[model samples]
Target: MHERIDEQITFRRLEVLLAFMEGGSLAKAAEMLDTSTVSVHRALHALEEGVRCKLFLHQGRQLIPTDAARTLAATAREVLSTLSSGIRTTREVAGYASSVLRLGSLYSLTLETVPAMIGELKAREMGLEVDLTLGSNTELLDRLSNGTLDAALLAVSELGAEFQTIELFEDEIFFAAPTGSKYAQHKTIDLQACSHEPFVSLHEGFATYHGFQRAFHLAGTTPTVAMTVGDVFSLTSLVSGGVGYTLLPGRIRGFLKDRVHFIPLDSRFQMKQQIGLTFLSIRERDPALLKLGVICRAMAKRFGIRT
Candidate 1:
């Protein structure tokens, strides 16, 4: 039994074998690889010898590959493709020509904040591509910490010292109910008064979830949660459909204004969420991140969210 493969088998030999397999003739393979037919013959011969198998049938000038040769050629193609992907990923990790910005944010931001930021970024940088990832606040922060995301727009409360943040705006959590609901007439809501009312809430890890918990805690009442959804839009939809009510950030007021009633929470039950641009401290001076910071600040001012 062959315990070890021959050292003569190399990537160059595999490449030559694949080229020959595709071209179907020594002359054609040589032409495809920009080499001499004699060199191609030598490489194929060496490859067959190294593998200790009859890879081709030498019938006069026509050479026909065996099944084994075809299989090896297929495997070689996969190997090369995987290696190419690895090389590209290595370059990305090394920060080489990184024109693609991996930006993460909460699902709620896609309505306006993310779109505006991406549009502004494209205007400033030629040939720049933005990869937007939307998730919960905890998910975005985790991606940022692991280097999976170059930067993220999320609540800055849970950020670590290793990250540098630029606070964009401060948003207040408001009591949300369906339009024409009994609570619509109130200028502000007291969570205690609505303790018995059925409500839908965002799942934990979302920035609004913390606010939901905090407001209810401050109100000294635990709300009756009918359901917990993964995204803010779905939660808002449930509320709009009269399934329940929720506490959501004021930033999303415009998105559901027609369908839902947004009443500010009483002063004692108010929970403020500080939205910001967060990136690794080591990348604070990165040109793309710096430009993003500028865009976020301008967006805050334009939206009258500057704090």
Candidate 2:
């Protein structure tokens, strides 16, 4: 009995009734809704049954509205209007169609990629503002999954189905040592030969950390990690002060210029990190994101991004 009552009072039926009341005829209502006249008439009849009220007078194919229908029409208009506004507000909170874009990125990108991307975005005159959050790839991915971030720039890896990704470039991991270190004199450093060397690393969950482990594992040796820090800046500082050697991406070379020496890894111990832009698949069509995609694609050309 409750199910039957619930089925009758639906938003679709209310919309039909409102359309008929406003358009004043079955033909006009059908035209307004882009439906057939039969559908419009059927909807109105069903709406009346659902409300358990006499909503019209039938006089030779004409539907004369009842006082009850007039009242119902006003209420229907209000209900639909409120629902429309609610949907817009909800989407705004979710970072779609909002004035601000909540963007997340790895701390390493702060040196070059992120700053350049944000500059181009602002210069486009799109009137969209960016709220930047920087952290490890794992932290950024977590924020994206929880709806706290609209999109993220991170290492491209096997991601869940909920994400849409655009690959920007591939960066090779290099051995980073303090200036004038004997390791820098080599054209390509061999990780196996340096197994006894002291190294500083970013903590777990960072892209660089993952690469660091992979390179050593391939070399069939484990590094002597003296310390693990949280951010790339600190990791670089530790390396610069000669605390320990570490593996870093080529992109951060500029940041550690003149302070650290970055040497390529031998082929047997080499690792490459693919950097990309990622967002929720559901928000791929958002206007702000579309604009952001345009800007990123233009930048990707510099790195010869794969299609």
lDDT of 1 by residue, 1-307 (tens): 7588687788888889988888889998999999999999999889888989989998988889999899889988999889889977875784434788888988877887788888887786645688888999889878877888888889878556798887777888889989999999999998888899998999998989988988888888898999999999899999999999999988788876899999998888877888888888987766667667788778878767653
* Residue 58 lDDT in candidate 2: 92
Give one digit per residue, the lDDT tens place, for model 2 in 43-93. 888888888899999999999999999998999999998998998899988
Query: Total clashing residue pairs per candidate?
Result: 0, 0
Best by TM-score: 2
* Least accurate 10 contiguous residues by lDDT in model 2: 1-10
Query: Which one wins on lDDT?
Result: 2
Clashes of 1: 0
Off by over 4 Å in 2: 1-5, 24-42, 56-65
